[model samples]
Target: MRKPLLMLVLAAALNGLTACASAPSADLGSAPGVKEGSTPSKGSTLIIKDFADRSITFPSAPQKIVALANGEMDIVYALGGTLVGRPTATVPAALQAAQSVEQVGSTHGLDLEKIALLSPDVVLGNHPLNTKDIPGVEGVGSKMVLTSANSIDDIKKQIGLFGQLLQKEDKAKELTQAIDQKLQELKTTPSTAKTRVLMVYGAPGTYMAALNNSLSGDILVSAGGENIAADYPKLDNYPQYAQVNTEKIMKSNPQLIVIMTHGSPEKVKDGFMKEMQQNAAWSSLDAVKNNHIEILPADLFGTNPGTKVVEALDLMSKRLQAAK
Candidate 1:
């Protein structure tokens, strides 16, 4: 799945954060290493930590923070931490209600001065910004936490790491458990049929579906839907724009079609459906005839999985399972 186009897409926000199928529960049996009072001193302000490290030792817990990446912002919210600042236009809609937080320039081309002026005690950044922004972030006297997540396990670990940093271990535990339970719930339920699905990506003049392992493909599998493109497994095509022959789409005869376009919900819906309707071959597909098309929000259906990803699975399951 393509990353959602934040209209004002700030410069190089980190990329390639992937999600995977759930792992065995036994693998997650233990919590991260940290005692209740092990928090960094409130007085000590400087600290640095890497994503791979299992433990973080901060001089003081960060009370005022600026999140420079989406993952960091999500983690902060998951841990119930107060964010004093975040990159503009990068925050998810779920968090748009937070009006008090300051928008320090875009993470990619960050306004160093605005961030510095915040006097943030800690700055959270991912791989893309870690090296470039570290010196400036540190020069401003704030600690910087560098995080990178490539798989679902990494995402879980981040939840725990942020929990420890924000003293919300309990919240972290609860959210993790919820995710684990949802995966388990999906695992045990048998799908009546592996509904063939096509995850159509939309751009100005390009439209295509993803094979397995991409964000959209992962969600389809998690929801018990099979990607019709799985058979044509082609590599070296990222944000691949291979023109999908309409005849091929008809032949695949996907049981359902999901249109994922990035933009405001209203615009994305009107445009994708109108386009789908215009394509003669697409209009002839079983999915289109049956009206089994779902128009998903750009942000939720775009890149990177999180709580909303889990919800997407449930939604797909319920929709796909309904008798046609």
Candidate 2:
């Protein structure tokens, strides 16, 4: 999953975790088969059932691509591809490939006018967030592929899709294998008896507990951290998160806290800390008093990590183990 861009209006507070009811019976991440490392066959295009399970047909291997989310941008770049345009978000650290791409605006506030002017062949975006954007993208003569990396499986599926789309299956497999190996190594980490964790997503002064459905929460679990917010009812609009409750936090008494935010990390952290101090019980929570709080790297946590997912998982695993 991404911060969502969610870091989603939880748009940015959480980014990439959702299931679309309108999707087809097929897995959203599946793609039409092609030979490994083979070029697109003549007189044909690629097709994929996006994360929403919608059928998306590519007229040809997209030349002028517009990636509407940072995670997507990172993935495209990781596949040895460049972008014609990208959202105005921080690119992941591993995506060192620079492009002279235009800023088409954020995932939530896409500048359609600018997008149309680009005449992109393909537009990649975060699902559910960009499902409504299909019309706008199509209006610009571009086919949109909306996908998200909610879990390790989701990330691998997305990478495979992009690999097929970019004619870079070899690279995609390499990236996916790294994730597999990392996860295998993680299985060997001695269980910490489920280190209690509270993952909060920040937007301005407001914050919500990220639920198990979120990308961050997914990684938290892989790292052996049990999300105390797992049982909380999800927000109708932002299903990946729930309204943060001090009473709930106190009752859970989590052993670790991880905060993910978009802008001004210090301000958001300070605001949360101020709120915690106002309540003696909240301040005395194990995570708080033991200084077990962690602010995940904005590039890797709040948004979808894409090709940087291996690093993201490694970071989360270390965090959980440290708290243990």
lDDT score, candidate 2, position 308: 82
Candidate 2 lDDT score relative to the true structure = 0.76
List ranges where model 1 is wrong by over 4 Å: 1-49, 52-57, 69-71, 90-97, 106-108, 129-131, 148-151, 231-248, 265-280
What's the TM-score of each model vs. the native?
0.71, 0.85
Q: How many Å off is the CA of 45 in candidate 1?
A: 9.9
Error of 2 at 172 (Å): 1.2
RMSD of each: 9.1, 8.0
CA lDDT of each candidate? 0.62, 0.76
Q: Per-residue CA lDDT of candidate 2, range 88-150, in tens? A: 766554654644578888778787666766778888887778878766556545677778777
| lDDT (Cα, 0-100) at 304 in candidate 2 | 83
